[model samples]
Target: MTMQTRVNPEVRPGTPHQMGAHFDGEGTNFAVFSAHGTRVDLCLFTPDGETETARVPLPERSGDTWHGYVPGLAPGTLYGFRVDGPYTPDRGHRFNPNKLLLDPYTREMAGGFIRHRALYGYKVGNAGADMSYDGQDSAPYVPKSVISDPETFPLDATRLRRDWSETLIYEAHVKGATMRHPDVPKEARGTYDGMASDAMLDHLTRLGVTAVELLPVHALKSEDALLSRSLVNYWGYNTVGFFAPEPRYFGPEGVAGFRRMVDRFHAAGIEVLLDVVYNHSAEGDHLGPTLSFRGLDNASYYRLAAGEPRYYVNDTGTGNTLNVSHPQVLRLVMDSLRFWVQAMGVDGFRFDLATTVAREAHGFDRSGGFLDALRQDPVLAGVKLIAEPWDIGPGGYQLGQFPPEFAEWNDKYRDTVRRFWRRDRHAAQDLGSALLGTAELFDKRGRRAWSSVNYAASHDGYTLADCAAYTERHNHANGEGNRDGHHANYSENFGVEGRTDDPAILAARQQRVRNLLATVFVSQGVPMILCGDEGGNTQDGNNNAYCQDNPTTWIDWDRMDEGLIAFTAACSALRRAHPVLRQTTFLHGAERTADGLRDVEWLDFDHRPADWSDPALGRICLHLRGSGESATGNASTDEVFLAFNNTPEAAILTLPKQGKGLWQHEIDTARDAQASVSVEGTQVEVAPHSLCVFVCAGETP
Candidate 1:
């Protein structure tokens, strides 16, 4: 079963074109990039990868790449790189030949990362800090890269390539979404195979989500600080290997399990999108351990400070920022993206801390090198590209600044919708803008309504259930004294904090959750629903549960709210049934020449034109008509009317008159059922802190 060959294979000069270990039937070629290293050695290991068997120096060097070939070595060969270079931390060169470095282009990894003092390049308690070099061999503590053949696991499923206008994204974690499912096999739970099981597929298909945006699946290492506290980076923001999939999520078939999962998802008509974190690595600050990147030409791989090279430019809140501006680093990212699409069969990507990748020396740029490369890439241009759009660096919040090719996560929409439901002052005006795709911010640059990815709750914040049941964050379990997450959550506790048994308070909380879900589905954008939000899942008010991998973060399938799930499904079906709701064109209240009807209309409670300057207004009505220039090509003459009331008192709203059609009640957040009564009068009373929807019935006006 083992693929290990003789202890010492015949070595030959290999070409430097390929970056990583490539198996070409007869032998395997090993290549790695190291700009400042004087020598590069390829270390071969046993089948278990616990001990080194041979060390052969690369016989050739072309430009910055060192390469060599072994005549008899085949796939599954365990190997790693050791580069010899200057060890000057102050000048930003932290290469140590003693440390075993992982190949940046590794497709699979062997063994596991063992935390030890030998992993660090410098002595633990030396007075010179990183300047003092340590000569300990780290092969026993580090993982070895495995030579893999892509042809072994071929992906034949066709890409779904769902259009942006019709996408309803369900953000989920690979393990959290499947770990608690009762029907999944015991051994498959929390693995890639579990996500593709029949139970999971049925749940997602029944919910009507077009795509599932998975959290990071890239290989990562937990921080030393979190390991000391018995916690981990559950969200996977800390990436260690871009090419290798996380070994922890692998099923019985290893890397092939990921391919099968993607194929199954595609067969079920659900696209898969990965949330990628290319901004930084798992290595921490200047006092951090010398991982792969730090040990292999640190000055070329990372962005060092201008005058003081000992420290790194903390553009990302993480310890070191990747120098994506560098040509080789940029190539590494692009290669990884293409490999995922062509070999792995992913439909799209969601970039975390995206601003850090698009930033130049000056500041965040829409046409920066990284963004420009993506814009012109033949393989990437057609795929879905989304950006988190912000970081903690100087001038990092670059919302609505990306090119037309990319959609952005709109935090403005989230805040506005939350504040409106919480009855914040002047929130009505902003709420209207949010429902209209925030045209003031994204209408320019030829961007369509789908460019705004609207969501009320995401992974980094409180869940929708917690947003209605708790005002203060209960993150004491995160071990940060509850000071880690956002303080102003724009949430309301109804009557009591955390959980309450009061019937009235519980009713209020349920209504608020329904209202929020309704708002997201009816809005003109690509809507994203947080996983388990539809089932009324809560993290015990732990808004910053990034490190909790227990029941607190996992979705409890047995305790789901069935009524809320049905309501969420109904909202999604409504959006899919109406083309006017998911238009690619932005509506600006402009009259359509085809029917002489305005695309959108705003009104007050008395059916008069809404006063834009009214700060005390808590009620607003929207009338949406199909645009003649709708890009979907299925736009009909049908119309929709929405009424939102955040005040403490009920209001009588007048419905717009249609010539030959009558309005039918479609949705009411105050109740669970789809109220399908035909309107008999022009005036309808809307309850306080609720929303109502009416659709045109019979004929067109």
Candidate 2:
């Protein structure tokens, strides 16, 4: 039964207690925070969201919030806001009453925002630019915010609260993951329904990823430049509305589709983490279009320059930065996060350019208000909070500086693992530090090893296939003169640059793939993988395919490297089965007991004690066995030894002795698919640029 009341004209002044459009069964309350607005008009839309039906002025103002109640409006009602305030741009105010702004707290937005010149606050070709006024109606070309009672979904967020130590994040785009899959119905392809299908759920469950960190699904504005180039924002980093889910990813039932998607993921014992961009909105720089935040309260919502109020602080390098310093702006962010978790059923969030979120007046304060609020928030403190941890601003490469509540995306681990697998000199030290969870960075402040979220590949960089098959970033299709992505990719092609016909090069590239996969899974800390990297996804060496939404970015399910996929699966299974690999506490050099074997022992290729400072050594031999408390409070696990060979030729590695039990080899990157591990006498020959794993029972190496 519909829980909405019939439409009527019994309008009343409402309290400014809550933000956004909230329907309370009898009436709908509309509230928005605009600190500098003189007047706020609530523009109601037709059923099709095309024509403006009525314009009601909000009659109450408490603090910076403008609020009112439309006594008979129901949950399905569509609306937008137009706030009247100062129009001058020199002093950091860009308000235009003609342009309808989206409610920052809008739960569901109707997408089909037709790009038109009238949507801009300033006239298109006027020399006076932003100074000139435009009186055109923007309702004809913009999306309308919908009134939604987010209490429509089931509230069972108890089961999905996975600890950081057990999280295996699978970073993927909603459309790119299952758009071409044969099992997903043709009509449901690339929609939220498709991602929630049995095939997608089965794949994630079988692959053993505990969580799926989806690329941005928030409603965003397609950049005009990319539109002119006939490309869309595949990454969805250009966010316009935080609370609203992207319409393109939805099916016939609108918000219900996303709700079902999250429900299904949780049902499969997998968590869902959204890649959110709250640092800035879709509004571009000085010459950018005036969207929601820019048109509503630019001076309050954005961080204007202290010296020059008209200019913005370009900390995010995304043209503008959200001023989280403002109380109302901070409230918007906190409310948005809580809404996504409690109302929308998402388990966690991965903040993109997260350093910008914690920035204060002095610049990048660890104890900033944003982090302080998040730490104290009961709803958010328990969920997974991950940060990209860096931006393009000055002093923005903050790797291990986040609060204890958050786990940072470890790029150092990615680079060091790549260099170690590629046999760079002096890489053993870096690899060893990463394999131990970067104790120097995270061991302080009562943080655990899981604070460093390790990964070999991510969505922003080259896939594992590209990392082994291409040295240079071939991003020619990004329409930016092949200069859009990173230049130093830490990638290498064995004998060919892109693709080759040589069997030896192909074999070598496959070995490198297995090596990288084994590195992430075998190393400590939470491991993340790019979605199709397990299936050999490639963008023709395109490291940055942010704008290419076609096959260049989509995962080609048919062309998967079956052998590499099997290897990755085995690695994931090994990581899950062996508690010794996923350690919660730091590995001390001491043994588990006084006279027992060590928890972790470092050795050279000759089975001797390792000289960590030696620059000539490039191999990593680590024997790991846990006896202390882990993340789950249980420890005693199997003893496992891992050997990584980074040299140019085979090396004879001396083996540790056991009473009567033999060391059973588990993995060798040099071996073929499903290769049996035959016992080699007393010494094992490790091939060049490969990794090997052997399970031992009461052994010392």
Judged by lDDT, which candidate is best? Answer: 1
Give candidate 1's TM-score. 0.97
Assess the local accuracy of residue 101 in candidate 1 as a C-alpha lDDT between 0 and 100.
89
Tens digits of per-residue lDDT for model 2, 1-701: 01123343555788788898888888899889888889999888777886676776898988888999988789878888998999888888888888888888887787576778877888878896777778887877888898886466434445388877777999999899988888888777788888878988888787898999999999998888899888888889999888888988876556688878888888898998999998998887766777799888999999888868777888888788999888988998998888788767888899999999988888898899999998899888688889999988778889999988788899999999998888777888899999989888888788888888899889888999999999889888888898789877889998789988899998888888888888899888899999999888888899888888899888888898777778877888888988788877778676665336688899877888888877867676998877564456554557788888888888887767655657778889887674536455558999888888987644434
Clashing pairs in 1: none
lDDT of each: 0.88, 0.84
Top-TM-score structure, candidate number = 1
lDDT value, candidate 1, whole model: 0.88
lDDT (10s digit) by residue, model 1, range 1-701: 13245556678998999788888889998888889988998888988887688888999999998899998798888898888889889889988998898988898898777888888999988897778898888888888899887585343435789998889999999889878989888778888998888988998988898899999999988888888889999999988899889988887777888888988999999999999988899887787887688887899889899999999999898788999998889998998888788888899999999999998889888888999998899877688999999999999998998888888999999999999999888899999899999989899989989999999999989999999999899999888888999888999998899888899999999999999999999999899999999999999899988898889988998888999999998899888988889999899999886767799999988888988788867889999998884455644576899998888999998998877778888889999666478887688999998999988886644
Q: Ten residues in a row with the worst lDDT in model 1?
A: 1-10
